[model samples]
Target chain A: MTEEIIIAGFGGQGVLSMGKILAYSGIMQDEEVSWMPSYGPEMRGGTANVMVILSSERISSPYLKVFDTAIILNQQSLDKFQDSVKPGGVLLYDPNGITIHPTRTDIEIFQIEGNKLAVDMGNAKISNMIVLGAFLKIKPIVKLDNVIAGLKKSLPDRYHHLIPLNREAITKGMNNLKPFLVAEMILK
Target chain B: MAELKLMKGNEALAEATIRAGADAYFGYPITPQTEVIEYLMEQQPEKRTGMIVLQAESELAAINMVYGAASTGKKVMTSSSSPGISLKQEGISYMAGAELPGVIVNVVRGGPGLGTIQPSQADYFQSVKGGGHGDYKLYVLAPASVQEMSDFVEDAFDIAFKYRAPVLILSDGIIGQMMEKVYLKDQKPRMTNDEIIEKYGNWATTGKKGRERNIITSLDLQSEKMEKRVHRLMKKYKQMEAEDLRFEKIACDDADYLIVAYGSSARISQKAVELARKKGIKVGLLRPITLFPFPKKALFDLANQVKGILSVELNAGQMVEDVRLSVEHKVPVEHFGRTGGIIHTPEEILEALEQKIINNGSIRHHKTRESSIL
Candidate 1:
């Protein structure tokens, strides 16, 4: 099995870290994974994107043209990668400040109010994890246990205290995921 | 069993430098490769393995420091990107002239002059064809994956000391910045001074005890003496070419066409090979692991079997010249690439193969394609 994903958003939104966590989780599950990020000037106060792949076999190319899933966190990312999602694929996004919505009818679209949820949870930094949890709920490609293990491995020892809170955020995200209205998408 | 961990390619190379028992690392921080020094400084290999990691003031200083450390028969290395690597060319030539054993890394970025910080393979001509101002060649190893980014450190050091020649790990920003699972070997201890004396005493300036005073210099005023020294350097390069050539072939047994590439381009082209095969096109990949001791013979043999070859790189066709020369223009060798930090996609590569190699025969060597078109 192979899953090619692109995670794109602002630099500080943990786009890279979310990809890293997914990569680590794939490792924890004994699968091959690659994480290739868009670096240089485009990362400073601009759009940041990372191409991530997880496969049972060895991954051929870390850089990809299209993705099986596109996890977008901003309107710019939505606009950039909406067409990049493969047909019959998944497009997950956090529609907090997004002015534009994805209009792809051939793909499954899911939306999460990640920023608002994180604000309600009293920790705005956990929004990425909530979005990740929403993705896991839809696909369940990686087990929750492996994700927690991946989080433990990626996070420093000093930040170990926040694992439980992050887990709660993830659970909340999974519980609150909403499918975008296909009818509304066509109208727009 | 080895330690399995997920690491960025630059970080893996840094950790491998420590684990490979390197004596010192002297490098200037450059984009796409700053993580090499960052990881080394954070890990503090000095505390762990008595190794030294210093942030040199400039690339020139860093390379000269490597030359100095390598003169003592110590396993030493430095890392930088394309522009910084260009700065160290003189020092690299000097080390080559002095027959110093050291590892230099160029995590290449797009460039003629500070072009971009994104990944590029434009330095192909500069690296394999001798960038420095001498007829000297570094044994260039192109690593395609993060695992090789880590593993080639040990292999490069071994080959460097074996030939008493400078070795370069020719990597690009994609491999430098990407993260993947890598198997790291156990830490090896650095050699003692006594061991250095025993191993490299004849050439290295390892204190010059109980023998004629060892002098290390690439300078010889007399023309005859300089000619003899150059011939000896040529001999060493020849020996490396004979014994140290490395390459990988995939699906070549039944291939009608071939793709020649190295480093990250090879990885991308491998996917293209797969895509082409899915459409019932018989294509293969030839990845030259060592660029200096290039797999010319392998390509020549494959040229006899394949109808055409597409040389894919992250540059505007540098290695294609080498590919043409390797096959002696027997096959239609065309180049397909994207320059200035844009990576070519696999679909585009296959499209180029169909268009440039299969369809378009009017470009060059039309006579060669006319006979092979059958």
Candidate 2:
């Protein structure tokens, strides 16, 4: 199966990093993957977005007008990409930052308090990891151990101390997402 | 050969250059093409193999530095995207006039004036025909896959040195950004500086000596000598046409409709061909791997066999003129494409083929009638 996801937010919000982590996870899973970013002036302070496509077979076009999933970290990003989600697809939103509710009934929306969960875990910047943890809950395509391994491979040896905190953030975020998923399943 | 590893196209290009015995890489950072410079910087091939890597002040300076390096018979290269490539045209012309061997990579982006930061095949004419002033031609190689991206660098460098001309890898943003598996080759041994001087010491400007006075200049004041020099360049081009024409033909023997495309557009066109076949149409693709010295003979042969030809590209009708020239009124040639960074979908191309080929209406009739009457 092929999964196409878009991770979008304001610059410095780790949107690109989240996309990279997913791409790395795909690589670990032995799936063909591509991570493409929006170039030019848009990368400065404007919307920074990346498209990550993971497939079992060869991928055709890297440019997608409609994405199967969108991980939005801010209200602007949610407003920007809500309309582009494919029918019956998934939309993961950081509830702490995003105030705008999705208007589409065709998509399944999951809201996580990513920033609050990360702050409670001691590293507020680990909001990206929190969202990733929620991603793992919704779509268990890659093992949590594989993600930890991917993160370890990406981080420098000098920054190894941060690994434990990151792991904690992920665990805490995953624990916080269970109630929501069960409720969503019951609603469905 | 080694195990295949997932790698970006620019990284593969850099790795391939090192394997191809490249001695120098000079370039500036540009979108889509920056990874090439980044890979070279991170790999630091020079400390291991004595290669030269320099981030020049501008694309102009980078190409001129390449000119200086190539004059000494060293395998030198530089890379950039559209606007930067436009800046390097003057240096490219100078290199052509002096008959130097070098490799250039153009990871093209949308353009006319910074049109977009997306992939584009609009630089077809700029790279195939001479973008730089003066009568010149670059041996342009278009690679569709990441594997081809790595493999073609060696071929481009070999052909450049064989004919004493510049070779260009014409790539787009998609190829630059996309990752795919590539098999890295074992490093090739390269010639030392002394060895290069010993071989091409006649014209290289290393330094002035008592007996070795090497001169490297493109200026030729004498009209007859300049004319003779141009003729020599033309002769080299003709030789390349005979020896270095590379293309791929897919199920084209009895193809009623021929789709002429290259690079990323060709990849999409291949899918279009499959869709056309499912609908009971005998469609095939003619993908030109080498854009310059364009596979005219292949198209000419196919023209007599195919009922119609469709030129597909990411840009609006750029390479279509060349396809038209090759067919030369023997068959109807139609063009379908998108511009300003929009990628053409396989469904859109199939739709055009259906209207122009399967339908085979007034357009084909008019062409056939005119040809018979003539």
Candidate 3:
């Protein structure tokens, strides 16, 4: 199956890096993946976004008019991409950054307190890792071991000591996502 | 043979230049092309190997440095994006006028100004028609993948030195940023400065000592001499046209419709071909790796066999004109594309091909619009 995802937030919110990690995960799975960033001036402290397409077949156009999933890190991202989500698709937003509830009833929305969870895990910067954990829970196209391996492969050698902390953050986020998983299973 | 590794187009090009035994790289950093410079800098070819890499202040300065390096019979290169490439036109024209051999890579981004950092094929006219001033042509190679990105650098340098002309690698941001597996050449092509001096040292200005005074210029005040010089350049172009044309054909031999495209556009067109085939339409693609020679003969031959031709691009209709010229208006040549930083999809191209070729509707709509607008 082909899955199109858009991760959007402010420049420093790790949205681009999140997209890159997803792309790298797709590559590890031997899937065709393309990550296209919004290279406009909006990249300078403004809202930054990236479009990623992971497909079993060859990907035609990297641009996405309709995305199957959207990871919104802030209110601006929620407002910007809320309507672009396909019907019956999923949207995962950060409750700490996005306060406004989505007005649409056709799509599934999951709000996670990513910053609080990462802070509890001892690093606020690991909020992206928390979101990624939630992403893997919702879409299990890649295994946890594979993602950990990808992280190790992508991270710089000097930062190798932080691997366990990152893994802890991912585990904490995954643990916090149990209620959503139970609700999704009940709906299914 | 070397092992294959995944690489971005920019990195692949840097590696290819090293393998091609480039004496020096003089370039400025620009979007979609910055990795080439980064690779050279971090790799530190000077200390590890014996290659020279310098980050210039501007595209103009970079190209001028290339001119100086090439004049010394050294294989040199520079790279930039569209806007920066616009700034280097003066130097390119000078290089062409002096008949110097050098390589320049234009990793294209969308723009007339500082428009956007997105990928675009908008510089088709500027590249094929000589972006610089006066009458001159560059040996232009359009690469679609990381594989071609590496391979074409060596090919461009070879054609440049063989013909004593400037060679251009015309690529867009998608090709520059995307990663793909590429197999590099095992051994680097050998070109020594001392060897070049031994061969062409008579004319090179090596401090103007111990030799007859040599003048490197493009100026000819006399009309007769100028006209003769232009003719000589024309002759070289004709020779290139005869000998150096390169292209890739996919399922075009017995097809009823032909898709003429290049660079990233060709990749999408290949998908369009597959979609059309599944729908029972005999479709194929003709991708030109060399934009200058235009692959006129190959396209003209295909024109006689195909019922129609579709010119696909990321710009308005630059390559369409060349296709029409090649076919001599024998068969209907239609155009389809998106401009202003928007990329054309395979579905869009398939829709156009179906409506025009299968349904046989108004194929000339875009052609008329292009002519009227131009």
Candidate 4:
């Protein structure tokens, strides 16, 4: 199985790192993976996106137009990538700064209070991990153990102490994800 | 055992240089390729293997430094984006003319002038057909993946020293910026100065003790001697073409439509070929790994089997001309591309194949188009 995922948000939101962690996890499981990012000026302060692919077979295109899952963090990303999700695919987002939510009917839309959970955990940096946890809850493409191993591999040794907190954030995100009722929101 | 690590292509290439036992890396940082220098700086290969990494003030300085280091029979390299690469053309020409061995990497971006920081293959003509002045050729290798990006460093150096010619690693921002799992080979120890003198002593200026002094210069005022030098260079190029042409064919045996591409474009076209095959369109992909000794003979041979060929690139249409020339108007040849950093999608490629080759079965030759334009 091949999983093409796009993770988009502000540069500081750990968008690129989240994708890196997922890719590392794929590697831990002995799977082929590729991570291509929208680099340059946008990576400084503006929106940043990374295309992460995990495949049982060889991955063809590193840059993709459509995705099996889109883990969007900000409103701008939601606007840009909502239509890019494949039909029956998953669109997981953090209900933080998003004003315009995804309105897709064919795909599954799930929202996790990633920002709030991260703040409550005393580190807003773990917000991406929360969203990643919610993604795992929806589709466990990679094992949790591998993700923890991935965290160890991706994070520098100095940040090793915070792995438990990040792990906690992931668990919190997994439990708190709520399916968004698009029709009800439209009616309101 | 080889160490397996997940690394960005640029980072992987940088680390490979150290493992390849390179003597020095001199480069000015540029977007999409700066990570190469950054990784090298962070790794501090000087501590581990005594490999020197210096940030030159400019691309010109970096390339000249490569020239100086290479002249001493040292393994030297420099990398840059499209515009910066353009700046180093004069130095590159000097290296080529002087028959100095070095590796020059161009992590190509959209261009004519500082076009975009995003990936592009627009430098095809510039790279394959001599970017610098003179009739010299740089052995060009276009790596399609991160693994190739890492692996080609040693390969480039080997070819460079073997032929005493510069080798170009023609990459793009996509390959440079993307991350993938790469198995890095074990570290090889750098050759000692004595070893260098022993190996390249005849040609290299390792100081004159008992032997005649070696002079390194591209200048020969006598026109007859200059022509002979150029002829000798041409012979080396011809030798490279005959011996070192490398390419890959994907599902070409039963294919009716063919796609010829290299570097990042080739990687994307691989997907397009798969997509077309899924839709019952018999398509194949020919990826040229060596751009200078470009898979001309391969394309010429494949032309006989395939009904039509489409050259895909990030440029408007550059390699298509080469494809057309190789096939000798054997069948219809078309170019489908996106410019200024826009990478074409697989679906769009399939659509182009359908419209340009499958449905519109016309044997449109380059000469005809050129004459028509004239």
Best model number under TM-score: 1
Model 3 residue runs over 4 Å out of place are A1-4, A26-33, A53-61, A64-69, A75-96, A99-113, A178-188, B1-7, B180-190, B194-215, B221-228, B251-256, B271-283, B304-307, B351-360, B363-374
lDDT of 1 by residue, A87-150 (tens): 9999999988887677778999999888899999998999999999999999888998999999
Which candidate order results from sorting by DockQ in descending order? 1, 4, 2, 3
Q: lDDT of candidate 3 vs native?
A: 0.83
The models' CA-based lDDT, in order, is: 0.93, 0.83, 0.83, 0.92
Q: lDDT of model 1 at residue A16?
A: 95
In candidate 1, chain A reaches a TM of 0.97
Off by over 4 Å in 4: B197-201, B361-374
> Across residues B119-144, which tens digit of lDDT does each residue of candidate 3 receive?
89989999989788888998899998
Off by over 4 Å in 2: A105-107, A167-188, B1-7, B193-215, B249-258, B268-284, B301-308, B344-374
Lowest lDDT block of 10, candidate 1 chain A: A179-188
User: Can you tell me the DockQ of model 3?
Assistant: 0.25
Clash pairs, candidate 4, are: none
In candidate 2 chain A, where is summed lDDT lowest over 10 consecutive residues? A178-187
Each model's backbone clash number: 0, 0, 0, 0
Off by over 4 Å in 1: B363-374
User: TM-scores of the models, in the given order?
Assistant: 0.98, 0.85, 0.84, 0.97
Per-residue lDDT of model 1, residues B40-136, tens digit only: 9999999999999999999999999999998888999999999999999999999999999999999999989989998999999999899998779
Worst 10 residues of 4 chain B by lDDT: B361-370
